[model samples]
Target: MAPSDYPRAAIVTGADQGIGRATAIALARAGFDVGFTWHDSEAGAANTAAAITALGRRTASSWLDTTDLPSCAPVIEKLAANLGSLGVFVNNVGIGLNSSVVDTSYSDWQRILDTNLNGAFLCLQAAAKLLIAGGSGGRIVVVTSIHAHQPRFGFGAYCASKFGLDGLTKTLAVELSEHGITVNAVAPGEIATHLGPDETRHPHDIPRPGIPLGHAGTADEIAGVINFLASPAASYVTGASWEVDGGMAQMGAQASSHVANNDWRQATRKGTSNGD
Candidate 1:
């Protein structure tokens, strides 16, 4: 088949729910066949596959535990064989643990690091090899987090793993650009998803009160950024971390308070404030 006639294939890990699920559907809608992997949510994965099929696109689902590095190559091989070619690889598999450095156990730290950092590295390596062998320039988009840049009070392990991912993204971007592959990341903050609960209050989840957008973002919003990075439109963009937060990460404690005060003043001026 000619290059234009070849079917486009994309693999999205952790795609059973949240940002990953949204991205899989978006890519399918964009006319790319999808190969998605879920670690524990078989029903959710099947639902995602059905959604893609409903979009008139092909989809395949797999049970992929990202922490298993040795399984990466075989899974990629199987996905490539099933889809014809892999044009995009999304490293969306990650784990977050909320614990202070002193409270975090070694095993918990290792689990978070292995899943968030090592898994991403292994998947990227396997995908790069497959794309190079196929002789097709591919796109690799990693779903990093705002914690990759700014550390939270009780998420030491999570922050460390994401910081490592950020560094890996930049390194891979430099190394893979020569091969016509682009490497980039999307950093989302306070997104409402199964991965991040809205009701469960964590130190990181404390409403900044000063975010310019003034609300938590949705998983679809973050997925939109990831989808864009995987598309032809982002061909010239790489080695960057696009923040999809509602300006929460940009506000310092004092700045956030100031913004809240300003909002209060505006509300009072407009007689819309609830006087306590």
Candidate 2:
């Protein structure tokens, strides 16, 4: 291994595919033994493990259903045991909802909260305990959404959950700083992972003029930031949220998923359309 590479153990939740899978593999490449948890598809989790093994890194995986909040702690403990120790934990389990508050059912709201917030709390808490006991200091990266800081139409439940998670990220950062655990959040805008028939395609060639970058971000893009956060290079960074949008936050506009018009592509100044 290179002098910069540290042989450690890292765990990522919800690695069935997309950003979580990308993160798990990236950490393996960074010289960490990886343990990942997946939900929905066992095949996808196997694929992730296979990729990590192909990298010549140690890997283990287990199932994770974030809606079952009580199940989170045990899964974390099991993964930590399988990996030998925990130096990094990426809290990457989340589910989205597409309904306004008035249109949302109680069940849907509860499920979103249980999965995205309550379950996440349990998982992070469990991981933090293991890390603190290890006494080696660790990294905790939370995967939030651009909605964590902004609001979107028809996504009341999801937005609320992410907002709460963002707050949790900050709180954990401060609380865990003393234990040498750096806590951070990665907030992604619309990524191509869920956009097309080829769901795994990155930066799908779709016309999304609403974003300054003119396209959606990719899972790998988000994973790149996460990989950095989990590394020794980012040892001094903590309690910060990295917004990985394509300049959407600067425009203060909706994400690509909520934009249907190309009007946002142009700049408007004092009632006059501006910008080339």
Candidate 3:
């Protein structure tokens, strides 16, 4: 295919590692020239860019702290300009300050909201304007969490931010329909990444009781769903929040008890794997 016939460019934030890196690679494999942002992991981001370039796709990256709202527009503008077109915007940057309502200081709450919710909104706004100006339909995917639907203890601020992001997804979907822009969310449950303590990449060797699927998900799994949404197959789909968790949301509060009891782990002890 000619260059113009090739897939348009895409921007993925927080792509230094984990899900963000996976999504960037996946999009590149799907034929998009990828541009991504990183907060502190310049090396990780460089590796991700190298991987994409190795895939024969153009890639660009810069340091971007999502909480720095003032920088959103310029970053998007520069990336879109460098790539020549903007077709996909993945709002994958977020942080969860583990603290209860009482323990969560005002600064902590604001920090989480600023990065998780406000930053996403600002980036989305800038990307949407670019898409509209291009006069071509685009895709906007936000990476949320299962906590978005079912709250978790000590995650008040995180849950609230995700919930707000979901709401924004729907509202933007409605407004952007006329422009052929589809807005959606991917709510992942427990996905293992470099960010995890063990750095146990997903598809763990052992099952995890916290998730009904018996193990944490892989970043590639979530990236697959995101790639689908960014593809032509999802052209007609909008305003939807896909729970990419392995049935974690369905378990609700029982998730905690199951984790504590360890009874659910007995199945694995019986010499049977969860089959990933």
Candidate 4:
């Protein structure tokens, strides 16, 4: 098949369910062959591959443990070999840890950081080498979280990892742009997924009543942003974190009110007073 006839190949991580699964399907429908990774979800990954095949696109699934870097390299190498070329890489594998900084154990923090930040770094490096070898421009989209920018009360480890990812994304965009590789990140807030409860009053759930849309966003919504970033339409966009939240991060007042109305402003004033 001609290059035009053959779909571009994309690799999506953590694609068994949620935003990652939706992104794989979206890319396949948009004329991309897909390879996705899932950990301990063979049935779900097979289902995703079946759906992609139904779209008349090629699909591959592999077991991936992001924290296990040595094991990850071979999976990506095999994906590139099978797919003929790797044109897009989506780093969607991540874990959330919610605990106060003092309560967060060293091991837990390391695990979250390893999976969320270090894992993505490895994948990006592998994908970059493959793309460079292919001599074709590539797209790298990272699935970060709104917590990358906004700090949540009890999610210290999660926030740190995501915040680090945001920095990585920006730096990669700058370094890779000369190679025709565009790197970007999407930060979603209060998405209804396995990471958090969808109900209004779950103890572990962050109440999103202050979101301008007044509802939890769907994984598909977040996937839409990833899809756009991977498409030709976003050719000029890079090094940016597109927030998929329903104005959650923009609502500083609401976030501050959870503690005290005046506390936020007072804190801000103190920072300003101290030349911060």
TM-score of each: 0.85, 0.88, 0.88, 0.86
Better of 1 and 2 by lDDT: 2
List RMSD in Å for every model shown.
8.6, 7.5, 6.4, 7.5
| Deviation in Å, model 1, residue 220 alpha carbon | 1.1
TM-score-wise, the better of 1 and 3 is 3
For candidate 2, the clash count comes to 0
Give lDDT for model 3. Answer: 0.83
User: Given candidate 1, what's the lDDT at residue 99?
Assistant: 67
Candidate 4 off by > 4 Å: 1-7, 195-208, 257-276
The predicted structure with the larger lDDT, 1 or 3, is 3
Cα RMSD for predicted model 1: 8.6
lDDT of each residue in 205-233, candidate 1, tens digit only: 55556566766777778878887888888
Worst 10 residues of 3 by lDDT: 267-276
Best by lDDT: 2
Candidate 2 residue-wise lDDT, 1-276, digit = tens: 221333399999989788898899898898889999988678888999999999998888888787877789999999899878888999998887667688889998998888889999999999999989888788999999899998877778888989999999999999988878889999998766655475554465676677788888878889999999998889888999999989777765344466567764332212100000
